[model samples]
Target: MPLKSIRVLDLTRLLPGPYCTMLLADFGAEVIKVEDPMMGDYARAYEPKTDEKSAFFHSLNRNKKSICLNLKSHEEKQYFLRLVEEADIVVESFRPGVMEKLGLDYQILRDINPGLIYCSITGFGQTGPYKDKPGHDINYISYAGLLNLMGERDGKPVVPAAQIADIGGGALPAAIGILLALIERGKSGRGQFVDISMLDGVLSWLQILLPGYLTNHIEPERGKQTLSGGLACYEVYQTKDDRWLSVGALEPKFWSNFCKTIGKEEFIPKLGEPIDQQDVMKYEIQKVIRRKTLKDWLEAFADKDACVSPVHTLHEVIASPQVSARQMLQNIPQQTNSLQQPGIPIKLSETPGKIRSQAPEHGEHTKQILSQFGVKEK
Candidate 1:
């Protein structure tokens, strides 16, 4: 494994920080998750717990050790500082000053270990006007102008099913920053701080839209553009059986072929016209799509040049032929028993990742982890 000896001290809970640590763990890093002694991660209490463990908690926290400690305690704080002295990375997701109040901020950690990569993930950032404001994934997306581009033309903005702001904007970028800092540390032999803001990540994802708004001075609206949902060439249409098919005939040639396939070749001339005219063509295409079942449409376009595909539900996605062939899903046995969990995502030929273990019980390895730091085992 690439990161076999790399040690990560995880002081994050819930989604973003745990997800980042999970990615590192999958690649064979030694991740020690530190949690509050009493409650642990709040996600542990989320509904549908099987044997006192939430699926959400289990899903994101595999292949890691858990240590429970009360940070407010002087003895526990000393133990935590000892752990930092030997760690390569320390990741936390508290609001700005929480760690400082606990006397475990980056400056203090660096004093213990100058080569430690201290990453802080938050809603806004470390030093912005909105840094102290309480916010979540939805709030970050809303502030970044991403929400305005979603949903129907005149309807309210619809929340996307995926946690784009949390995972994409926060976790993924934080992971990348940590990796890059590790690389730089090899050259300089010094570690630095990584401040990752979810709002910044979300806005970075909307860079393409930002340029258009700046260059053309046109404020984009909900479902009023090709990428949003206005164009007939790229949108979702409901079939007779109520299933939806995603039609992404964005290219000129694909659009022409799709129009001919649906017997709407006459409307090909207005493919990229004004929103009103495109809506008319969209209605015509929707009417044609509603006349056939999803299976019928799938079979009809099986050999065609059209770029159409059925929107898959979670179950269908897991059972998909492509997913199976790519080995995207794997069964990870439960830590206590032989039951399995979801497999790792990325595929590396030589050093592929595996789900070595399920999420640990709270404070399951507290004594062992503290022992590693030369603290007396409790």
Candidate 2:
């Protein structure tokens, strides 16, 4: 209930912005999802349906209310501005000039309420040359040089299953920025614009790898980084049963133990050597891992010093003991039944985030929210 008193006007439709607002809503913020009257959030119509709503939409948009309006219209714009007067935060994920064209940019809203924290999540940000360029998660990551660093060496860069740029790049940073801005607002008695660019966020994630490249003036290639797939000590291997396990024996002791236990003692001395000099160690380890089933290796390494782990599937992930112990999954009570969903990641001992309600049907709370905000429909 830490943010129970705060109200957030959520104008983000898709992943990044909605995910950011979802975090706020989870922590007890009054998140009013502002949507266009004609179609509402495009996510409401997204695929992979769960009963009547989208499983995708439900995953990202729980614990929020919906309000329908046409920001382009005078009356509705005025109504939104009126709601802004009482709102503590506004979150949107439009391109650079959309809000300005709609006459609802940060400056216009700031004139209405000086303490409003307005956050804009975009691909390239408002000031860059690529500001007006249209892009998605893939494009943003590629632009940030992140995509070039992923996948096998000399192979095509593989797209990750998850939206790293959208969720990690945009949403997480936007959430952090909003919180920091909120804290600053408490002291300054004024709010500021939070411009969250997915490209910038993705670039910041290269802190560890960038140091080497920046110091050496060398461009890091895909799968060549020390922690990536460049070394035999830190990699994945297939088992006899065709299942996979990961090896993270980066230290000397761990590598020695791993090689000795796997009967590849010759590899212990070659640990952390240059790729061309001892790349055969990777093949030797793969052969060793493939000789035994996944379960066999798991049992063998269960009590060992080697940092080995099973590469779990989705079902295995859901049933993981660590996941259960951490409460990463929970049953959220919906209308008549309980729907299982992801739990709050940030653990607050006393004021933990809660899923108070399921995602509203598009504009489900329009009348009620308008009335609550004292904006009577004309």
Candidate 3:
């Protein structure tokens, strides 16, 4: 595996940093989750537990080992420094100065280990007006202007079901930054700080929309943009069974194919007409789609070149044929019985990511890891 020889000391307890380290662990990196001896990860107490263990925690912390320690203690601080000396990467999601307050900031860690790739995942980043402000996934997206752009036309913006700010904005960017820093380390023989802000990450996702807003000096509103449901050819329509189907026939060819397939050739030229005309066409398309069941529409478009697809529920998506074929779900070996969990997303011809083990219990390997790292417990 690519990261088999790499060692990551994960100091994150919740979503963003844990998720970042989880990706590394899946790719065969040695990820040691360092948690507080008292509570461990707060996710362990998250609701919807199985046999008293948090399912949420299990989902994020798989393929990693756990060790407990008090960072404020003098002895434990020295022990952590020793571990840092051997670590290739260190990830933390604390506020701006939390690590510095604990005497474990990058500056001090670099003195002990020059080749340390230190990654800091925060809401606003290490230096910003809101650096010390606390926030979660929703808050980050709200601040980044992403939340305001997510709902219906003229309706109040809806909270996203997915934690895009957490996973997309923070975790994925942190992983990418760490990988880039590691590559740079190979050439420079020195490590660097990787600052990943949820706000910055979310803003980066607005590449398409931001340019338009900046260039035209027009503030893009919710559901008013082409990709945001302003077009008749690129929106969701409800089927007769009340299930939804997404129609994304945005291109000319796809729109033509869809219009012909649905026996609505008159609507072809109205694909991207003015907003009022598009709304009229959208209503007509919705009425047509409502005459058929979701299953019927799926079958009708099965052989068509139109970009139409069913909007599946979570359960339906889990059992989908494409998802099964892609191996997006895997059986994780837990202490009791094997449990099905989300599989690694990135597919590599060589050195592919794998789920080596289930999430570790709190402080499950503290003594063993200490022994392996040559730190004698006194």
Q: What is the lDDT of residue 295 in candidate 2?
A: 95
Give the candidate order by descending TM-score. Answer: 3, 2, 1
Model 2 pairs whose backbones collide = none
Cα lDDT computed for each candidate against the true fold:
0.90, 0.90, 0.92
- Give the better candidate number (1 or 3) by TM-score: 3
Clashing pairs in 3: none
Model 1 agreement with the true structure over 260-331: per-residue lDDT tens digits: 888998977777799888888889999999999999999989988889999999889988899888777767
**Model 2 Cα lDDT, one tens digit per residue, 168-206:** 999999999999999999999999999999999998998
TM-score on alpha carbons, each prediction: 0.97, 0.97, 0.98
Top candidate (TM-score) = 3
What clash pairs does model 1 have? 332-340, 332-341, 333-339, 334-339
Model 3 lDDT per residue over 1-378, tens place: 999999999999878899899999999999999999999999999988765788889989998999998999999988899899999999999999989999999999999999999999999998868999989998999998998999998898889988899999999999999999999999999999999999999999998798898899999878878999899899999999999999899999999999998889998888769888988898889999999999999999999989999998999989899999999999876667777878889999977999888899999989999998898887
lDDT accuracy of residue 74 in candidate 2: 90
